[model samples]
Target: MKKMILSALMLAGLVSCQQDFNPGTNGSSLTVRSGTSFGMCVGYCRQEVVIDNKNTVFTKTSREADKNPPVTCEKQTDSGTWNEIATKVNFDAFQKIPETLGCPDCADGGAEYVEIQLNDSRHRVTFEYNKTIPGFEDLVTAVRQQRNAFADCK
Candidate 1:
C-alpha cells in the first residue's frame, strides 16, 4: 500500500508544471541564491534569483516606495542550468571563501552576494563587483550568469 501511494505522488509531480509544483524546503538542498543592490537613489534597484534542482524564482524591484514597482517571475530549472550548477560549482572552494567577505573597499557602496545551501548548511559570500577578489571569479561568473538569465522577469 505504501509503494502504491508513493508511486502516485511521483506520477503527480511529473505531470505538474514547474510553476504549479512547490518543492518546498523540506529535504532538498543544492539551492543557489544570488542578488544585487546598487545606487543610493530613493529607490535603488535590487534583483534576486533563487534556484534549486527543480524550480527557479526571479525578482526585481526599485524599492518599497511607489516610485518603482516590483517584477517577479517563475521558471522551471532547465537541463543545461541544472547540469552546470551541479558540475561547475565546487562547494569545497565555495566554503573556503570567507563567510564575511563584505565590501570593505567598494567606493560605489553597491554590493552583490551569492548564497548556496548544501549538506544542510547555508553559505553566503558577498563582494563588490568592481573590486571582486581574485580566485573566486569563476564562481561569481557562474552565479552572475544565472542572475542574468532571468532578465525577462515579469
Candidate 2:
C-alpha cells in the first residue's frame, strides 16, 4: 500500500510539472510571426516578419508582382531580443483573445496580425492596423519593432 501511494505521488508531481511548462519561456519550440496588409495600395502591400529560435525572416509582397516583385531578408535572431519578447508571451491569455477583432482592412484602412506557435499549438489574432490588442500590447510592440528593423530590406 505504501509503495502504491509513493508511485501515485510521483505521477502527480510529474503531471503538475508538465502542466506548468511553457515552451515560449525557453524559445526551443516557440515561433512568433506578425504582419500588415493593405487592400488598396501600391508597392509592397504586405509585410511580415517571423522569428524563431534560430533566426528572423522578413518578407514583403507587392500586389503587382511584375512591377515590384517580392523581397525577403533573413538574419540570426538576437538572444536578448528573443528573450524579451518570449518572456512577454502568455499563451493562455493569448488564446482567450478573439481571432479577429474589429473590421480588419475595412475601407483600405489596413490590417495587422500576430501569430504564435509553440510545439503543436498555434494562435493568431488580427485587428485593425495600428490598433492595440488588450492583453498583447507588449508582445505586439516588440514584434512590430522587429519588423520595422527590416524596413530597408527592399
Candidate 3:
C-alpha cells in the first residue's frame, strides 16, 4: 500500500506541472540546487531556478521586475535589487501566466547554491556553512507550524 501511494504521488508530481510542492520532510538530507540559466526557465517559466527538497519551486517575478521596475533600484541589494524570488506560487499545470521572467539577453553572471539539510536542526544547515536560505527557512517554518507535521519526517 505504501509503495502504491508513493508511485501515485510521483506520477502526480510529473503531470502536475506546478512544481510547487507540499512535501513531508522525511529524507535523510534535503538537496537544493540553485541554478540560474540564460535560455529558458525549466518546468515553469521563471527568471531564476530553485529546486527544493520536494522538487518544489522558488519562482521569481516578471523579467521587467528584474529589469526596470516601476519603482527603482540603485544597487543589487534586497531593497531595489532582486535579491530573493517570491515564494508564493504553487504548482498548477493549467494555470496561465500572463508574463514570465524572461532569460537574460547577455548572460553576465549568477551563483548556484546547493544546500543539504539534515533532519537534525543541531547539525549545520549544510556541510559547509550549515546555513540556510530564506526559502528553506520557510519550509522548516511551515513544517513546524503544522501540528505534528514533522512527526512523520522524524
Candidate 4:
C-alpha cells in the first residue's frame, strides 16, 4: 500500500508539470521561456524568432527542395538583451505573416505569435494568440499605433 501511494503521487507530479518540461534539443542549453506582452493587441502574433537561454537567435524560414521541409532552426548570435521584436508589428499584418509561413499545421484560420524573452539573455518571440480578451481597448490603440508606424516609416 505504501509503495502504491508513493508511485501514484510521483505520477501525478509529473503530469502536472508536463507543460513546463524542456527536453533540450541538439546542444542548446535550456531555460524557462516566459510570455509577457509589452503592448498587446486584440490578439497576439508569433515572433518566429527562436531565442534560447544562451541568447542565440533564430528565424522561422522555409527552404523547399524536398527532404529538408520546414523545421525549427536556431541562428548563431552573440549574447545580448532579450525582447520581442514583432511587438510593434500590426495585429492584422502580423497575422498574415504566419498564415503565409507554416501556421496552418496547427490551426485552421491559423494563429498569431507573441514576442517574449527568457531571463533577459535571449531575445525570442512566440505565437500565443489567445481568444480576444475583452475590455482591452489599450490593445486596440497600440495595434493602430503599430500600423501607423509601419506606414509612416517608409
Tell me which of candidates 1 and 2 scores higher on TM-score: 2
Task: Write candidate 2's Cα lDDT for 43-97 as tens digits.
Answer: 9999999998779999999989999989999999998888888887777678778
Which structure among the candidates has the greatest TM-score? 2
**How does residue 54 of candidate 1 score in lDDT?**
81
What is the model-wide C-alpha lDDT for candidate 2? 0.88
lDDT string, candidate 3, 1-154, tens digits:
9999999999998876433423332332333323233333332222222233333333333345545332211111132111122232222311222222232223523222333232332111211111223435553333222212212221
State TM-scores per candidate.
Answer: 0.68, 0.85, 0.22, 0.24
Where's the lowest-lDDT run of ten residues in candidate 1?
18-27
Q: What residue pairs are clashing in model 1?
A: none
Q: Number of backbone collisions per candidate, in order?
A: 0, 0, 4, 7
- After superposing candidate 4 on the true structure, give the runs of residues whose Cα lies further than 4 Å from its correct spot: 1-4, 7-12, 19-47, 56-111, 114-154
Candidate 1 vs candidate 3: the lDDT winner is: 1
* CA lDDT scores, all candidates in order: 0.69, 0.88, 0.31, 0.33
- 1-154 per-residue lDDT for model 1 (tens digits): 9999999999999766222112333325578888887766456378888887788888888866476678888888886776666555555667778865666326757778888777566778777753453566765677688789887665
What is the C-alpha lDDT profile of model 4 across 28-137, one tens digit per residue? 43332222232322322222333343443322222332533333344333332221222222232322333222332253443433332222233222333332223323
Instruction: Candidate 3: give the clashing pairs.
Output: 18-91, 18-92, 125-130, 126-130
RMSD of 1: 10.8
